[model samples]
Target: MWSGEESSRLYALRRFVDVYPTITKPDRHVRFNEKMWTTTFVLIIYFAMTNVMLFGLSGQALDLFSGFRSIMAGASGTIMHLGIGPIVTGSIIMQLFAGAKI
Candidate 1:
């Protein structure tokens, strides 16, 4: 358990996180069909984006992250080439700061 002082120190961090723009949670339970539909729609969009090659780029363009493509879930020459990178980086920095109390 955190002492009062520690909790107070973290309060500001918590508030900052709360105000950050993010997807809001539903107030009520979501039905299975609704969940399935949402998942399916998102998957369709992801697949479509993966197949979309960047226009005007050469077919033999060098792929800097070819080996890490699967881990990044990004298409090397597509719109999502930086997939989840910013988000993950932000999360990592936040975690490090919180851990180090900085």
Candidate 2:
């Protein structure tokens, strides 16, 4: 009873899944100190990236999502323009797959 569009969508999703890489276990267990140091380093890098300005762009663009800045944990017009978008998108995809029992 599924429509043609639904079937086509399923086919596309199947093709994507076929090409997706399998998750591999980490080579070794991470110690607490190592994890903390890594976290600190990443945070420092993220903060530095957010502070870096975007070049070669006209200043005419407006940040409509300025209100959501606090929520996004990102500043506009920088490398963090779409702050945490990749992380959030990845989380959403993982949740969707988990919901689908994939």
Candidate 3:
């Protein structure tokens, strides 16, 4: 049905693919049990902290001075992102060593 209005669409096509005749608890917009919610919450907290730390009260302070400080601090963000690089690298290395790929 959506031909050229894809760019103007609100939600993605995949979400609209499965439709329920009636709205109930399971058919609600929000899925509370999913890991996406948890990841989104964590991202929000991380960005909030970064904003507060980087820009005290004035959002305009996100300029050269504050930017320099943030860069110098080597912001690996929270522990999860910090460890993710190493973990992914190690897993990839292990997989290659195990001859799992060409």
lDDT of 2 at 50: 74
Worst 10 residues of 3 by lDDT: 74-83
Write one digit per residue (lDDT tens) for candidate 2, span 28-83: 99899999999999999989887777896444778787877677577777778745
Q: Per-residue lDDT for 1-102 in model 3, tens only?
A: 557756655656667657746555656565657768889998787665443433233434334444544654433333322335787898889999889655
lDDT score of residue 95 within candidate 3: 91
All candidates' lDDT scores? 0.82, 0.80, 0.55
TM-score, one value per model? 0.53, 0.48, 0.23
| Best by the TM-score measure | 1
TM-score of 1: 0.53
Best of the candidates, lDDT: 1
Off by over 4 Å in 3: 1-33, 54-102
lDDT of 1 by residue, 8-90 (tens): 76666886896789997999999999999999999988887777887887758898888887885767787677577878999
RMSD of each: 11.9, 14.2, 11.8
Error of 1 at 47 (Å): 0.5
Compute the lDDT of residue 16 as modeled in candidate 3.
65
lDDT of 1 at 39: 99
